[model samples]
Target: MKRIIPLLIFCFLLAGSGCANKAQSGAGIGALAGATIGALTFKNKASGAAIGAGIGALMGYIVGNEWDKYDEKQVSQTLEANQSGQTSSWTNPDTGKSYSAVPSPAYMKQGQVCRDVTITEDGGEQILAKACRDEDGVWRLQQ
Candidate 1:
């Protein structure tokens, strides 16, 4: 009965927060899952909740922060590319982290919107930078 109560509460909280697309919802659900799992592992609900919330918050912030920076830079690069007739190429400049932009022709035909870009840094890290075209037909970050 005690275990079932916690499970039910967790479900209720997750569903309630999932109603919106806000990042807080992600953190909320993360905390719930973290707490539940932590409790099962350590048999301490308070410790679990605290640990879970801390983990969730940190993960959320990290993922969110990286995304925000990438999105902004991607947008700026896309528009600058469009204006200069040059494709986007980025590098850490300090770390020799370098990558080139591959624009989607479909989006470019519409307005040079670089929705998905391929990034290859010197560390051999290949990443996808997702971007979108703004109301002015200029590429921009989703934020």
Candidate 2:
């Protein structure tokens, strides 16, 4: 039964991502399936429901968190791509006007690339932005 619960949850999670429905709904469906299987296999409906709920919540949390993080990384990568060494005078895409940003020591890599930097704008100052060598070897900020 324990083994079955994991396999069931794995299938549900995969199915959920491939599916275009709501996360809570998908998790609820998985939990229902888990509970049904557990009760039938072990003859304990209460325990089965508890176990099903716990496993469902865990899987849902992981999938939700990973999806959010993946989005953030992509946006960060895009910003880093667009602003690498274009010049001291770069306009922030967010504000349209120029902002001052300076690359920290992190930007200086002997061989590897520096990227995903954030800049604060000020009066007439040259702003530094995050920049990276894109996969194509050309440095772009909005990759």
Candidate 3:
């Protein structure tokens, strides 16, 4: 029961944090599940939970980061292929999440090509994003 209370509190905190991005959300979820499993499987519950959380968080971050990359790839493609004011849309084959991006006119920023874009997720909120083209002509997303 003592352990359970902390777990519940952790869950509440995780929920309250809003997560913001896939990587953060993944780490929180992984830590929670790892703690639970470690507590059950090991005699030294604290050590077990700590170790499990570290490992789980690493694995989760890798997966979540990959998803972020995939999303970024789509964004980069859209930015490169579509003209300003035209919207490009796609569904992630792995996650089935659909998104659409509408890019504004390109502008020069510090000698590089940059464009502001709006991305909308199906049934979700829209995100205002920016991408810049590098010397190599690759479009990179900016925070």
Supply the global lDDT for candidate 2.
Answer: 0.50
| Model 2 lDDT per residue over 1-143, tens place | 56556755665565455332234544655565656655666557667756766676567555544543443344344444445433233453433544433333335455647664444444553323445565666444432
TM-score of 2: 0.32
**Candidate 1 structure lDDT:** 0.54
lDDT per residue for candidate 3 within 10-98, as digits (tens), equals 74366347434666666667777776677778898777776776676677667777777888888898888889889988887767899
lDDT agreement with native, every candidate: 0.54, 0.50, 0.77
Q: Estimated TM-score per prediction? A: 0.40, 0.32, 0.80
Between candidates 2 and 3, the one scoring higher on lDDT is 3
Rank the candidate models, highest lDDT first. 3, 1, 2
Q: Model 2, stretches more than 4 Å misplaced?
A: 1-29, 76-143
Q: Of the pair 2 and 3, which is ahead by TM-score?
A: 3
Which of the two, 1 or 2, has more lDDT?
A: 1
